[model samples]
Structures are given as C-alpha cells and as structure tokens.
Target chain A: MKELIEKYREIGFKLTPQRLAILRFLKGNTSHPTAENIYRQIKEVYPTVSFATVYNTLQALVDRGEVTEVTIDSQKRHFDPYPKPHHHIICIECNKIGDVFKDYSDALKLPKNILKEFKPVRNHINFYGICRECQKIGGIKYGNMSKSRAGCREF
Target chain B: MKELIEKYREIGFKLTPQRLAILRFLKGNTSHPTAENIYRQIKEVYPTVSFATVYNTLQALVDRGEVTEVTIDSQKRHFDPYPKPHHHIICIECNKIGDVFKDYSDALKLPKNILKEFKPVRNHINFYGICRECQKIGGIKYGNMSKSRAGCREF
Candidate 1:
C-alpha cells in the first residue's frame, strides 16, 4: 500500500488526505463501487472530504491507467481498481458484480465490415446472471430447484 | 406508424400525446437516444412533455421489450428500437454508435465457475472504435493515426 502511495507521488499525484483515503479504499476493492458509493464510504473516516475531491482522485487514477470504470448499472458509474484485463458478471437480481479473470479475445473477432470501417480497440462483455441469494429466494418462493432452474433460460 | 401504435396498444400501453410523439420519433430510430435526449427532442414539439412522461414511456417500452436500453454510454442510458439481436461499437472520439449484426456467443462463452454459480441468461458486447467523422477529426487534430487512437484511450 505504501508502494502505491510512492507510485502516485512519482506520477505527480498530490497526496491529499482525501485522495489517500480514496486510494486506500480502492487499492484492492472488487465491489466495483460508484463514485457516490466511494464518497459515502470515504466520508465515514474523513468527514470533510468533498464529492469533487473524490471525483478528482478517481479521474487521476483513471488517467494513470490504475483503475477502470464499470458501466454495467444504468443508474451510475462504478469504478474498478484492478488494471488487469478481465470481464464482469452482474447479477440481474441483486446488481452485485463479480469479476471473471479470463481473456476472451480469441472469440471476439470483429466482422469484416467493422474492420474495414473503424479499427476496433477493445471489447467488453456484460453477462447477466442470477446469484446465490436470488437462487435461494427462488427455492423459497417457487418451492423447487427444478422449476426455478427451468425459469432460467439456459442450463 | 399506425401499426406501431396498434402493436403497443395491444400490449396495453397508454398512448398519451407525449408517449405517441415519443413512439413516433422512436419507431424507426437507430441513433439510440437516452431518456434525457428523448425529453429534449420531445420538448421541442410538445412543450408540456415532462421528464416523468419521458421516463414513464421509456420504462414502459423497456418493460414491453419494444426498446432496448443500451448502457454503452457510461453517463446515461441509450435506447435502441431495433428489436433485432445485435451489438454496438461506439466511437470513443465522437460517441457515434454502429451496429454489428453478427453474434459472438461462441467467443463469449462464460467460464465453468461463472456458469455454475449463476444461471446465465443473456449477454451484450460493447466494442470501442473511432468513427469516420472522428477519424477525420483525428487526422486534422493529431496528424498521426497512433496519436489519434491515443485520444480514444483518454476515457
């Protein structure tokens, strides 16, 4: 964690208390929290942290390629700290996001016309699924695993 | 256009003036307008079109699956009226979106663990690229293809 702080300093990032707090919260976070969520979490410790500060720190981190933004939710943008190439599977029932660490580039071949027109840079896949909690709820509500599993389109 | 009204009506959708105007504008729209963008367009014709009406029509269309809500734009939700199964490639420079009719399900197969934990339903792929207009702008602004491509990575 201290090494990360040194890295931000080397990158000319100002080590403001608010920014440090934001960085600490995001360093190993997998929850993919929105800016509002980050602001709320940071406020618990640093009561004086402003929303603008949080946004600024996030912008800085994004610019540095240390974080990625997840737009799976329609309402607000969520931030991911991992710089690794991966995909996300979001539970349609709970809106919880889980990371899938695998490269599917082999499968994402662009169409001929698309390659002709615009040079494709990168691709993102969004998978919709039901989590364990939703599955448990299904068992209680529907009284059977077979019917609930049947309700889900593909096995 | 009459067919659209009757089709939505068959689904028990209320055809208010704003809803009808929105339906008319969106009947053949492929530009994928967001709710706010739709409200701005509708307000031009009917000054009384409230935000609520825009949201209500959007939610109604989404519920009926007449309009596909796209999350390509991280800032806001974009709507697609083309019920045909397709994907989108967004121009990172100009935010213009292009359609890709080909399916990449084979390439996007979820990992065994993800498939086991959550029942998979559907998937959407968003590809980032530079549009022709943006390509032209890129040529004028940067004078190098690599530099112009770097601009897209600014996000």
Candidate 2:
C-alpha cells in the first residue's frame, strides 16, 4: 500500500482522502467492483464523498495505467487493479467474475482473413458459465443467463 | 425474407407489424446496431413506435433465438440476426463492428485448472483496433482507446 501511494504521488496523482480510500479499495481488489460499488464503499468512510470524485479518481487511475477497466459486464464498467493481460470468466447466473490467468496468446491466432481487415491490437476472451453457489441455489434457469451472455446467441 | 417470416411464424413468434419491421431491419444486418439505432430507423417509417416496443421485440427475438445481442459495446447492446457461431472485430474509434467468420473453437482449450471449476459453455473474443477510416482521420489519441482495451495498460 505504501508503494502504491508513493508511486501515484510521484506520477502526480493527487492523493485526496477519498481517492486514497478508492485506491486502497482497488489496490488488490479482485471482486471487479463497479464505480458505484467503489463509491458506496468509499462513502461509508467519507459520508460527503461525491460520485464525481470516485469516477474522476477511476478515470485518472485508468489514464495512468494504475487500474484496468473490465468490460465483460455491459450494464456498468468493472475495475481491476492488476495491469497484466489476462482473461475473465463470468457466472451466467449471478454475474460473478473470476480471473483466468492462462495465457492463450499462442492459441488465439486470428484467421488470415480477419488479420487482413483489422490490424488486431489485442484480444480479450470472455468465458461464460455457471458459478458454484448459483449452481447449488438452482438459479441456473435455461433462459435466464445474464444479459452479457445474451450476445452469444449462436450457442 | 418470406422464409424468415414463415420460419418465425412456424415457431409461434407473433408477427406484429413493428416486430416484422424490426425483423426486416435485422434479417441480414451486419452493422451491429443498438436498440436505439434500430428504434430510430423504425421510427423513420413508423413514427409512433415506442422504445418499449423495440426493447420488447428484441427481448422476444432473443428468447426465440432469432436475434443475438452483441455485448462488446459497454454503453449499449448491439444486435446480430445471423445466429451462427462467429466472432466480432470492433473499431476502437468509431465503434464500427465487423463480422469474423473464422471458427476458433478447437484452439480455445482452457487450462486444466480453469476447466475444473466452471463448466465452460461458450466463448466470444473481442478484437479491438483502429479502422481504416479512423486511421485516415488520424483519431488514435494516446488515451482514446476504448474502455475494453483499457485493460491492456501497456498500450
């Protein structure tokens, strides 16, 4: 935590108390919290904290490569602190996200045709399935997968 | 078009005029338009059309496996009518999405560790980069990459 504070300070990221709290919350966060989630958590400590502060801090952090924005969830953006290339697996039932550490760089060879049209910068794979608790709760209705998976209509 | 009409009708999908208009708009659409985009186009022909009608028709079509909701865009859902196992490449500048017809299923083998926890259902890969027009327009600002690629902090 001290390292992060010093690093941000060196890079001109103003360590406002609320931003500090947000940075603290996101430092090693793995739950992939949304901006509102971060705001709510920060609001508990600083009752007067504004959403703009939370959003601004997030944007600044994103700008400085301090945080990663996970876009698997369509409704809202989720934030991750780890600044490495990785994949994500989301629970179709509860929207819980888990990190996938496997490097599929070799496996994800784009077809010759696509490479011709798109100068592929990078790729992120979204794996969809059910989570353990949701499976136990019997909430995996056949037609009720989360909206994100609504895109995978071919399946 | 007649085949699609008969196909949906045979599967018990109601063929209201608005729904038909939506179906016609989406029948072979590759543009990956959002619901609002679709609604605006439909409203040009049927000015009295409501957003609820467009959303409801989308939901119904998704339920019936007639339309696929593409979730690469975090702000709004885009729809694809061709319900085949395909992928997409999106321009980070103008949000232009193109179809990728290559099959990568055989190559997407999950690691042994991830395979044990979650039942792998399906996979969608989003390829991000600048398009020809965006490149010609010189819109690739240092911080202008879309939020999805915001995960790739190094870029």
Candidate 3:
C-alpha cells in the first residue's frame, strides 16, 4: 500500500480523498467489481464521490498497469486490480468472479493456421462455473445478479 | 445463403425484408461488426431500419445460438454470426479480428484446485497482435476505442 501510494504520488496523480478510498478498496480486492460496484461501495464513506471519480481512478490504474478491465460480462465492465496476469472463472449462477492465478501461456500455443496472419501475444481465460452457494440454491438459472453475496467468502 | 434462409424460415422466423438484409450482410461476414455497424450498413439500403430492430434481431440470433457475441473489445460489443465455437486474435496495432478455429478445450482444462469451488463449462481465448495494415499505417494511437477494427484486408 505504501509503495502504491508513493508510486501514485510520483506519477503526479493528485490522490484525492475519494481516490485514496478507492485505492484502499482496490488494494487487495479480489471481487473483480464493476465501476458501479466500486462507486456504490465508496459512496458509503465519500458521499460526494461520483462514478466519474471511480472510473477516472480505475482508468489511471489501468494506464499504470496496476489494473485490468475485464469484458466478460455484457452489462458492465469489471475491473481486476491485481497487476499480475491471471485467469478468472465467473459463476454462471451468480456474477461472482474467482481467480485462477496459474500461468497457461505455454499451453496456449496457437494452432498452425492462425500463425499465418497473427503474431499471437498474451491471453486471458474466463471459465464459466457454478459456485458452491449457487450449486446449493438449486436453480436452472445462470448468471443471477440479484443474489446478494454478503458474507460469501472469496477463494 | 438459400439454405440458411430456408433453415431460419423453417425455425419460425418472420424473414422480413430487413431481417433478410441483415442476414445477407452477416451470412459470411468475418468482419465481426457491432449492432450499430449492422444498423449503419442496413440503413444505407433500408434507411428506415431502427436501432431497436437491429438489436432485437441480434438478441434473437443470440438466443437461438445463431451468433456468438465477441467481448474481446471493451468499447462496444461485436457480434460474430458464426455458430461454430472458435478463438479470435485481435491486432493491438489496428484492432482487426481474425478467426482461430482450433479446439483448445482439452488444453484449457482448469486446475483441480479451482474445480473445488466452481464448475467449469466453456472457454474462449483472445490473442492480441499487430496486423499488416497497422504496421504500414505507422500504427493506431492506442486508446480505449483502439479495438474498433477498420481497414482489414488479407495479407
């Protein structure tokens, strides 16, 4: 956290109180929250904080390689704050995202055909799954957003 | 094309003039255009096609598994009309999307650890690269909208 604060100061990213709150929330956050999610959480303390501030801070983090924008969900974009490259699996029953930090770059070698046009770079894997809670709930629905995950533990 | 028309018609689709126009445009289109792109193309001909109609058709196609929505780009959703599951390579320099029709489901198998909390269902891979056009055009200045591919041609 201290290192990040220093880096943010060095980058001249005027770290406002709202930005500090955002940074603290994102410090070790593994929830892979959308912009609205972050804004809502921060609004509790920083009542004046807007989505614009959350988004701007996220954008700056992304530009600094301290965050990643995940596009798996169609409704909104999720932000992954972990700088280290990793894979994710989202519960099809809930919008819950779990990390799979293993490196699969070697196993992801492109097929002989695709090499003709593209010089393949890095890759990300989004595995769809049913979490333990959703599995216990017993429903045919996949990706249920209404279920509050309060107290639901993260892996 | 005739086969697809008959197939869709037999499946209870209305096959309206506008739907046919969209269908014909997307039949073998590898361009991976968004709904707005489809609307723009159809508007050039139909001129009266509404955005809602285009989105509705896209939603219907998605529901019927006639198209796969590509979320590799963060800015706008790109719809691919192909039914077959395949990977995609996007040029970092020009944003051109190329198809990779290889099956990597075997290699993409999740770790036994992740299997504890979530059930793995499907996987998709996105490879980033530099296309021929972007290489010649110097390069597209990177931006959040850098993924909107244009000027894609066969090498």
Candidate 4:
C-alpha cells in the first residue's frame, strides 16, 4: 500500500481518501471488478464517494498501464490490476470471469491476408462456457433446439 | 435478400417491413456495426424506425445464434452478422476491428485448474494492436515513458 501511494505521488495523481480507498480495494484484486463494483464497495466505508471519482481513478490507472480493462463482458467493463499478459474465460450463463495464465502466442499467428493489412500485437482470449454451478443448475439452455423451431424462440 | 426472408419465415421470426430492413442491413455486413450505427443507417431509409426496434431485433438475432455481438469496443456493442467461428483484431487507436479466420483452438487448451472449475465450450480471441494506418500516422504513444516521468503522465 505504501509503495502504491508513493507511486501515485510520484506520478502526480492527486490522492484523496476516496481514491486511496479505491486503490486499496484494487490492490491484488482478482475479481476483475467493474467501476460500479468498485464504487459500491467504496461507498460502504466512505459513504459519500461518487461514482465519477472511482471511474476517473480507474481510467487513470488504465492510462498509465497500471491496470488492464477487461472487455469480454458486453454490458460493462471489468478491471484487472495484474500487469502481466493473460487470458480470460467468462461464464455465458452467469457472467463469472476466470483468469487463464497460459500463453498461446505460438499458436495464434495471423493469416497472410490479415498480416498484409495490419501488424499484429498483443492478444487476449475470451472463452465462453458454463461454470460448474450453472451447469449443475440448468445445463445448456440455448442453441439446442429442433431446427424446425430453433430460430423462432426468444432466449 | 429473398433467401434471408425465407430463412426468417421458416424460423417464424416476425417479418415486419422494419425488421426486414434490419435484416437486410446486416446481411453480408463485415463492418461490425453497433446498434446506433444500424439505427442511423436505417433511419435514412425509414425515418420512423425507432432505436428500440433495431436493438430488439439484434437481441433476438443474438439469442437465436444468427449474429455474434462483438464486445471489443468498451463504449458500445458492435454486431457481426457472420456466423462462422472466428477471432478479431482491434486497432487501439482507431477502434477499427478486423476479422481473423484462423483457428487457434488446437493451441488454446485451458489449464487444469480452470478446466476443473468451468466446463470448456467455445473461445474467441481479441488481438490488440495499432492498425497499419495508425502505425503510419503516430506510432506507439502509450507505455513508452521515462521512469521518472512515466507514472504521472495521463494517456
């Protein structure tokens, strides 16, 4: 925590009590929380923290490469404090995210046509699946319909 | 267009003219448009079309596995009409998304720990890099700072 404060101070980021609370909450956090998630947790202690403050602080962290914004979720942005490169798997049924540390760069070569158009860089994978609990509870619900009635049903 | 209408009819998806317009816009579309993008384009032809109509139609398509929602952009959802399993590479500078068709499934094996917690299903990779245009325009700008001045700079 002290190191983080010093790092923020050296970076000229104005550190308020609320921002400190956010920083502490994010340190070593593996939940891959969203801005709203951080705000809800911070509000418990400060009771007066605004959502903007948390959002801005997180944005600053992402800008400085101190945190990574996980874009796997369609509805909201999830934040990762770990600086190392990694992949993620999300539960399609419950939106639960899990980290995958294995590197697959050796296997992810771009096709020749795409290579001609754009230079490749870092890559992250999003695995879509059901968690053990969700599997036990409901099993696979979508995409397993009779062809005659498949397209018409609403998910 | 007739084939698409026939497909929709066979699937029992309601075929209002407005819905047909949305379907027509998405057919063979590679641009990976957002809901707003589709709405704006459709509005030029049908001024009375509502955003909700477009959004609802998209949700229905995604539910039925007719379309894949591209979650690469943080601000809004982008829709890809192609149904084939593939990956995407996004330009961090311009947010231009390009499709990557090569299959990396052979190399993306999950670690035992993750496999134990979550059932393996499907996977998609999101590659982050500067596109050729952005590379020619500005080169890399973020994460290249002096240690003394790095942490303080805002992107």
- Highest lDDT: give the candidate number: 4
lDDT of 4 by residue, A1-155 (tens): 89989999998888999989998898877778878888999999999899988988998988878899898766678889877889888877666778899899988889988887678879899998777777776655645322222222111
lDDT of 4 at B131: 69
Q: After superposition, how far is residue B113 of candidate 2 from its true place, in Å?
A: 2.7
DockQ for candidate 3: 0.63
Which lDDT value does model 3 have at A89?
87
> Once superposed on the true structure, which residue ranges of model 1 sit more than 4 Å away at CA?
A139-155, B139-155
Against the true structure, what is model 2's DockQ? 0.61
Give the per-residue lDDT digits (tens) of candidate 1, residues A4-50: 78898999998988888888888777778778889999999999889
- TM-score of candidate 1's A chain against the true A chain: 0.84
lDDT (10s digit) by residue, model 3, range A1-155? 78877889998888788998999998888778888889999999989888888888898888877888886877677888887889888776666778888888877888777776667667888788888787787765533344654334432
- List model 2 lDDT by residue over A15-133, tens digit each: 88888888888866667778888889999999999999988988998888778778776577888887777888877775767788877767777777767666777788888876665
lDDT of 2: 0.76
Q: Say which prediction, candidate 2 or candidate 3, comes out ahead on DockQ.
A: 3
Instruction: Please report, as a residue range, the 10-residue window in candidate 2 chain A with the lowest summed lDDT.
Output: A146-155
Q: Write the per-residue lDDT of candidate 2 for residues B27-116, one digit (tens) a residue.
A: 767677778888999998899999999999998888777787787766777778787878888776656677788778788887777777
RMSD of each candidate?
Answer: 6.1, 5.7, 3.4, 7.3
Docking class of 2: medium
For candidate 3, what is the DockQ-based docking class? Answer: medium
Fraction of reference contacts reproduced per prediction? 0.80, 0.71, 0.66, 0.89
What's the best-to-worst order under DockQ? Answer: 4, 1, 3, 2
Q: After superposition, how far is residue B123 of candidate 3 from its true place, in Å?
A: 0.5
Give the worst 10-residue stretch by lDDT in candidate 1 chain B.
B146-155
